[model samples]
Target: MELNHMTEKSLIRYDVKETTKEKVIWTLVESLYEQGYITSKDEYFETVLAREKVSATGMEAGLAIPHGKSSAVKKAGFAVARLSNPIDDWESIDPNNKVELVFLLAIPEGEAGSTHLNLLAELSTRLMDKEYYSRLMAAENSEQFIAALDQVSVKEKEDKDTYEKTILAVTACAAGIAHTYMAAEALEQAGKEKGIRVLTEKQGANGLEDEHTATMIQEADAVIFATDISPKGKERFQGLPYIQVRVAEPLGKGDELIDRVLNNPDGIVSAENDTESARGSENQPANKKTGVLAEMGQAILTGISYMIPVIVAAGLMMGIAKLGAVPFGLVNEINDISYATHDNELFVILHHLDKFGFMIFQFMYPIFAAFTAYALADRVGIVSGFIGGLFAAGIHYRFWGIEEGIPSGFFGALILGLSAGYIARFLNQKIKLNKNFQAMKPMLIIPAISVLSIFLLNFYIVDPVFGGLNVLLRNTIEASQESGEIVLSTIIAAATAFDLGGPINKAAGAIAIGLAADEIFPLTARVLAIVIPPIGLGLATVLDKYVVGRRVFDANLRVTGNTSILLGFIAISEGAIPFMLRNPIITIPINIIGAILGAVTAVLLGAVQWLPLPAFWGWPLVENIWAYLIGLLVGTLFIALANIFIRHMLIKRGRMTITS
Candidate 1:
């Protein structure tokens, strides 16, 4: 797809006075709704907000693409606005620049599927052109801006030679948004300047989706992945000579790299230019160590991003349910009232709300796995990854034999992802197609082959492994319960602390879920276990802020921490992620200690509410509610003290730095 084809001659306005983030969103939302582009403001706002919560649709270079599919949308339309002011959001890397421009997209819910993702990929790639973006930015009015984009050839061509025989490349700094597209623009202009027919592909935070296919790739002399991101669909360039380098390197030494790829008779990026490459290599040491801290920061942010939708849906659902019900003390009185049977509207509404929330919760695993996979692989991974997650969840249910069954953990989704991804790449690499079949590639061929392989592979491989895992998991849960909740909590807390939110945590939680399935404890007990870790960590952070550090500590953490306890009262260990990331060493141990303590206390206090489901936000999960609260509180404080002691010891020894 070309920019021209996608760029419609719709009414677009510029220099709008939307200073705040909410204003920008609401302005576009309301505008779209009023203009028949959208049907309702509420639905569109929610859809956009949901996407934002997913990963900040914020693009690089002070741009944010906030687009969504909603029942409120009446038509597909794009509204471009330049923000007079900016507001804070996690995805905004440069707070100084704010969002100079916002691309608000509204599409009818019917059209809001994955199709927009492809459009996003195209727009992102094109906007990479600094010259292009500059034109858009510099335009005094909408007409000039539209005209400039109109001038660019958006028509994607099919001729293989048009893209091959000479190199076109895009190198972005973070393989995110701004720099990725900028690099592509740089490479394109450079190629055009050198009179080379070239097509450049972008590698951004969103990942690679569109690419030059078989004929074009086959005819190409070479290719380049000029970003830090992993090159998706790598098999497309299997035999082509490919150069991988940082985007900055290309920006600094484009001429040299280009010369080498195009057979520089002189010496640039050539064997003769080995010294140049060596000197470039001197800077390599600095570039390669992107740093664990940076990676961790991104991972934590990503995890938080994944968790939002689930929490929002769950919270709203539960809130509605709560609002619908009568006060516990008044329930008996209400039940005996004459009008009670006839007027259960509130109760009925609450039930429906709860049911709706539960349905959304079912999608949580799939969303988590899909987003994680997307974070790993980009746009190409979303659908496949989501499907993979569904498969994993299915497998989990069958294996666990839960009366309702186990929802697949994130790990299972990952397995499905790896299978689908590699298989897709393999097919792309090995299969040869003529021009006649080219049109079928994206629409049918790739997805068809990829899903088929994933299904077949899972059938043979994942199925059996799941069977073995089920037996082992069931027996272990039974044995552990026999040994008791103290042993179980210790194991879970350890797993929860390990790797923050990785496979280990998933495994432990799966075990808890498994135990719940077997009637080992009532639903309430399971709920308590699930939520304790976060509460413990949160309590520790509150009591000993120095250990967790004020730098990382924020008001939200407090809320999250409390929520974890709420979740813990119901027994969901995943609540501890935020606290765990702050100081893993102190946090993990604290969680482990707290889990054990909580378990012991619960048993001693004879708090016995048995429902596997997380206590609906912690209130009713415990039968002996006071004992449950005491256990949670005591366990939390104990863990906090443990964390403080560890931090103090580390500081005294100079093994850790308070400021660092």
Candidate 2:
């Protein structure tokens, strides 16, 4: 866990050309790649870049720790480069200093926040001492640098308790790299100068160092927390007198903060009355605009994060059940599962499985909304948020079946989830209570009030607005069918793929069904819309490397993509619903465009699906079957290629990140 144990002479390089900031990082990561420390250079490089976007890793002196924790990392290791020229563009804690010593850490996702803190602690202790840094920089070669690191303990020479008072200190930063150690050293140095002993714990990127035990905490006079982030294990310091400030505060004003804490104690942070905690009160008002936007985005991502497993499970089960029954000619192809025929036992079982899957799939929106609210307002907001999601799913039109209902869909879920969270959070904060009555806030008051608010919001506003929207869309698509072929095809494709089986999709389907019954128009666009998104997304997973020259989808998403392609062929679009829910901004537009391109191509080429057959097996019955095949290929390829290229560009530009 220590620095000496994790690194060796091979990792130490000197006299590197520092042409630019990126070149220095590339050098270290390349060294790590050469040593089999990382699996993919691009992935690890992206991870390091992503961390830099969160906050700068450069410290007060010439030190920089590029903490890269990723699935691409094969081992927990580091490469050290002493640059020939200082890189001033590297954003350091102290703006005046430039970076020359770079430590590019390759840490596997599993090794983060645990084993690396010890290495940081040891290295930080030495780096804080100017004489040690001079000796380290004075090394002639990698061997001498390794030897200098191997010979340590100069910073820890003094007796354990050589001061008047003993206090506990914890330091942390947003990136949990350089500043945590810098602040820890600062507090310790300040303690020494004030004739006090400071036992500092660093909650660094890889782990906690010099951690406090219960015994040490019990005997301590007080605690000082210098952290930009909230310190871990804060419950342990429940009743202890403490002073909390930004992690960077200690680098210069450690003595002043120490004097204030020892001379005039700060307030207590107990399990009770958490609204008044220093962690919230001290940092909440820092930035209004940036904080709100970031928090909202994180809440949505959190919801999607929790909802992915549910959709994956349900969608795969339904797809497999339908596909399994296909060979026996027992699949409905329209309803996805055969209803009246239960002659074969296996077919009957598959039908039941399909039903099970469909039933589970329906909870995706509710779960997404509930968890999103949970992210924003904690446990108190879950009930109302879940109910709001059910409304979004159109399950709230209880007076009649889903055929007559008009759900607002994902947009509704977003508004209701955010509303429920803020309402619950506000109530929890403003509604003060005695201990006996406190339990009622979460259990009764917040849920009742929030759920009522959601009901009123949906009934009077969201549902009706979307219901009117669906009617308007149906009219427009119907009217468009009377116009030019291109206009009608575009309308049909866009509307059918817009919400992926939501109200707008169903509305388009209603018009298409009527037209087909009357034999008024070719159903080329209508049928293609049913399969394009699922098939396209699935093909994207397989063709990602062929198109973009690297794996764009992670291992899990690739599996989803395969399942989606399989389901799409059987006349199912639900397979790609998860993609839409997770990344709607990109996925929906692509789905619509791909469907439109393919449908319009088929329509122009005189490929006609007049009998409402859209499944792969029905292709032979279409007029100009060759054209239909070409259109299908065009649509699927476009979806695959677009997804791969767009995602790759975003990752390269450090705009989008793939989460494992």
Residue 450 shift from truth in candidate 1, angstroms: 2.9
| Runs with alpha carbons beyond 4 Å of true place in candidate 1 | 1-171, 175-226, 229-244, 260-307, 323-343, 372-380, 395-406, 460-467, 476-527, 537-593, 604-627, 637-660
TM-score of 1: 0.49
- For candidate 1, the 10 contiguous residues with the lowest summed lDDT are 266-275
What is candidate 2's lDDT per residue for 384-464, written digit by digit as tens? 889989998888676565568877777788888888877877876677677678678778888898899989988899888
Top candidate, metric TM-score = 2
* Model 2 lowest lDDT segment of ten: 280-289
lDDT for residue 368 in candidate 1, whole number 0-100: 54
Root-mean-square deviation per candidate: 14.7, 4.6
Superposed Cα deviation of residue 370, candidate 2 (Å) = 0.9
